[model samples]
Target: MTVALATSLGDDALILGQRLAEWCGHAPTLEVDLALANIGLDLLGQAQFFLGAAGAAEGQGRDADTLAYRRREDEFRNCLLVEQPNGDFARTIARQFLFSTWQALLFPDLAQSAAPAIAAIAQKAAKEVAYHARFAAEWVVRLGDGTSESHRRMADGLAWCWRFTDELFMDDTAKFRPEWDSHINATLTQAGLATPKPVRGITGGRHGRHTEHLGHILSALQYLQRVYPDATW
Candidate 1:
């Protein structure tokens, strides 16, 4: 269970980090670019810890670097949402809001896992997740209530991404390993944010199904690794 959770969480961080890294110089403002880059770095750090823990638990010869750089897209277990393109600033914030909320909820539960190493990594990552969620939530409020254009864009972003959001809360591991539903609700309630009703259309990412964008993302991320199998920079 710890290994599975760690691998899933690591995939989440890795994919999202890659997406946010795309915004480093392309964001609307220098401050926003720096903010996104900072968050991307935080996710990358979380990915390193979680992937390292997963590798250790699996007793595989592969380490975090190999898992991150060498894996094919179908082997990646990140949700469809994170792999989606950052359409606009509003879209990026929308993605961040949804993902960070889920991660904040996830890491706390993971911190109590039976595996000591996994728990330790989660404990460390929980801090970063907390800040990620807060930053995204603040941006959500700012954009949601800021201006007519901002509100329209934010709402459109949320609508475009809403379908994929359900995948984040799907529970298949018989024991309800993380109780993600309750955590999501609690976080949204605390933030005074409400998602659309019913919450249907939950999808399964565990089956290795992914959005069309995953292939492109994997292509870019794996280029250096494939070209120089043993090269280090």
Candidate 2:
């Protein structure tokens, strides 16, 4: 269960990190672009640590490289929200706010997990995610309450992102992960951010079903590896 949970969380970070990297040069402003890049790097670093630990815990020869570069699309465990394209600045901010908020809540609880290794990763990741959540919350408020144009875009972005919010809270695994849902809601509420009600949507990422974007993302992310199977940097 420790290995499985850690791997799933790592996959979430990996996929979302790739998606955020897509905005490196395309964000609306230089500052926002740099901010997203920093977040992407943070996620990537977390993915490496978590996936590596998961592999070790599972007693598998596989490591982060194998898990990240060689996994098939259907084997990825990222939520659908992360794989969605970075539509607009507001859309990106909305996605960040929602995911970071969820991660912030989830990690702190996981930090106390019965699994020591998992708890360690969660403890370390919780700190980084706290900052990420703050960054996202600030952007959400700035855009949401900004000028008329910014407000409109932020609202539209929130609407688009709201649909995916349901999947985050649905734990079909019955793992009974304690306090995960309530913790997230309370944090977001305190921050004056609202997440959509926990209505189930098409949810299978944790079970290895992924969005169509996963294939495309894998193609690009693994291109160098695929092209030069025997080469290393």
Candidate 3:
């Protein structure tokens, strides 16, 4: 269970890191570009720690490199929300706000995990994610209230990703639902955006079932490893 938990966390970071990295030179402004890239690097660092710990907990010879570069799509455990494409600047912020909010709630509790390594990783990751959530929340409010077109895009982005929010609480930490709800609601309200109506959430990403996007991501991530079976860094 501990190994599985670590792998799940690692996968979340890995996939989201890849998604954010896609924005490296493409963000709206130079500052925005650098911010997204820095956040992506932070997630990748967390991924390395968690995936390495996962390999250790499982007593497997596989290390973080092997796990990251060799896993097939169905073998991954990241939530579907992180794997979704960065549809637009607004969509990316919406996804970041939603996922980082959940992370802020989750990693603090995980910092107290029975496993010392997990606790350590969570302690560090929690700090980074707290900032991630704040950064995203600020953009959400700015875009959601700034102009007619910006507000429309922000609302559309939230509605696009709202269905995936339920899966974030599907684990044993479901108790955080109330806090997540309050934070998200307050953020949206302050942004002059209406809260989206509840939708039936799509689940099962935890069980290695994911949307089509994961396969494409894995193909790019694993291409070099797959083609050069004996290559060394």
lDDT of each: 0.79, 0.79, 0.93
Cα deviation of 90, candidate 3, in Å:
0.3
Question: By TM-score, who's the top model here?
Answer: 3
lDDT of 2 at 158: 69
Candidate 2 segments exceeding 4 Å error: 172-200
Q: Count the backbone clashes (under 3 Å) in each candidate.
A: 0, 0, 0
> What lDDT score goes with residue 58 in model 2?
76
**Which lDDT tens digits does candidate 1 get at residues 84-168?**
8999998899889878877776667767754788778878878988888888878777777677888778777777778787677
Root-mean-square deviation per candidate? 3.0, 3.0, 0.9
lDDT of 2 at 166: 63
Roughly what TM-score does model 1 have, to 2 decimal places? Answer: 0.88
Error of 2 at 203 (Å): 1.2
- Report the Cα lDDT for residue 196, model 1: 46
**Which pairs of residues clash in candidate 3, taking residues 3 or more apart in a chain or in different chains?**
none
The pairs that clash in candidate 1 are none
The TM-scores of all predictions, comma-separated, are: 0.88, 0.88, 0.98
Candidate 2 lDDT over residue span 1-233, tens digit each: 87777788898899889999999898888998899999999999989988998889878698888888888888787788888888888888888987887888778878876488878888988998999988987877777666788877776776787777666776643343244456545544553555554444667777778778779999999888788874676
